[model samples]
Target: MKKFIPYILILIALGIFAGYYMYNKPHAETQGAKADITINPADLLAAFELDETKANAMYLDKIIEVKGKVKSINEVEQGGSISLDTGNEISSVICEFEHAASIDGVKVGDEVIIKGFCSGKLMDVILVRCSL
Candidate 1:
């Protein structure tokens, strides 16, 4: 039993190391990557409104390029969020940029195309790691 103790301890240490490595792994670069889907923001919002679960299964973790008019902008710690009007009064596609300064030229009512990963949806469909 004493001889097996060291082996067990080594195994435990290795398991911990493996978990930490995976947990800290850097995310892949989404910038400059070709979008998997290009669609109007209004259409995208409609899909989510119709079927959120299905929309998430199809779009989540996938890069999408959306074109729309900016409705609002809000700065955050990580960067900022741009709400794009989706031809709807209630919902919009919210694109979260990594750096607020990166969206310097963007403003309300500007027509722009942005690409990002479709993370999920709340009151709005959420896109993260957005870039022009």
Candidate 2:
């Protein structure tokens, strides 16, 4: 019984930890409310251009606020995607808004601020769960 007691305690601790972790899942609203960093779209793109791996380490999975000029916009059934000029003709910051509920009146050439999780560069910086 004494040996079993330690095993039982370990199980209980693990169960508690699992419960706590499950309770704290990532949510967009909460993440947008608190950005880890704020930077311009051009600067963010420049970082990746200089060193993709290093930039990924700095921005990946982090909530970031970016301000830039709108390059283009595309609407989809679910929502939409906005491309912000990164000062590079080839690449831009693509912000994916899972729900375009609030993207009314937005147009090209307009400057906007976006907050989302950085998913690293793929020819362009991708930001998911974006909010204006």
Candidate 3:
């Protein structure tokens, strides 16, 4: 009975560890899925009052999707970035794509939807994969 008790405890511990691992592991859908919430850069600017530091920190390194008018498109040999007008009077949101494939076919004045991990006030956004 004593030997069995130790084995049972070990089994229980293993089960708990396995459960935790599964629970915390990133899902395939989540890794690729855009942020569930839709936000406009203008609205975000107004709500946060253009607090770049605060806003950047709040959204930084997080996955988000935003819709706005493309104010400008910057293309480089390697890749490029875009700035969304967000209709905000004071500021625009910058979305940067490190890879060229992400920004292909995007143009200024076009309304676009972007998704990616927020690196800062500037979003290190992944462009092509978003469904919207």
RMSD of every prediction: 3.6, 3.9, 5.7
lDDT, candidate 2, at 52: 92
Best by lDDT: 1
Candidate 1, 1-132: lDDT as tens digits: 899999999999999999999999987656889999999999899999899899989999999999999999986878888999987888899999988887998889999999999998888899999998
Q: Would you estimate the TM-scores of all the predictions? A: 0.79, 0.78, 0.57
For model 1, the stretches where C-alpha displacement exceeds 4 angstroms are 1-25
TM-score of candidate 3 versus the correct structure, residues matched by position = 0.57
On TM-score, the stronger of 2 and 3 is: 2
Summed over model 2, clashes come to 0
Cα deviation in Å at residue 101, candidate 2?
2.0
lDDT of 2 by residue, 8-117 (tens): 99999999999998899767562338889999998999999999999999999989899889999977778889999977899999998877765678899998989989
Q: What does the lDDT come to for candidate 3?
A: 0.65
**Model 3 agreement with the true structure over 1-132: per-residue lDDT tens digits:** 787998999999999999999999963332357585567767665545557677666765566688889888876555577777866554676666656676778888999877755555433223322333
